[model samples]
Target: MALVETATFECGGCGTCAPSTWIDYDRLLYPVCPEYGRATGPLA
Candidate 1:
């Protein structure tokens, strides 16, 4: 069997979805994280 790769992106400014950790196997990268500025939730 063969393997396939794909990339996905999302906006962090508006917390429409839950945050996620990023992983890059090809290149070395510093620990990257998303910054949620404004969000609407039950706690808000």
Candidate 2:
């Protein structure tokens, strides 16, 4: 059996969240928000 820690990454004030994308160069755990676009920082 396996467990997942988090389902999605959320930015503050968005009220929504999505899976994160691996940015190789910058090495950031970030999400691509539809309404607000890409997040500037990783989740805290």
lDDT of all the models against the reference? 0.35, 0.50
Q: Give the per-residue lDDT of model 1 (tens digit) for 1-44.
A: 88955554344434333333342222233322244443322333
- 1-44 in candidate 2: lDDT tens per residue? 89877555565647555554422122364444555665545452
Which ranges of candidate 1 are over 4 A from the true structure? 15-44
TM-score of each candidate structure, all chains considered together? 0.23, 0.32
User: Model 2, which residues run further than 4 Å from truth?
Assistant: 1-7, 22-32, 38-44
lDDT of 2: 0.50
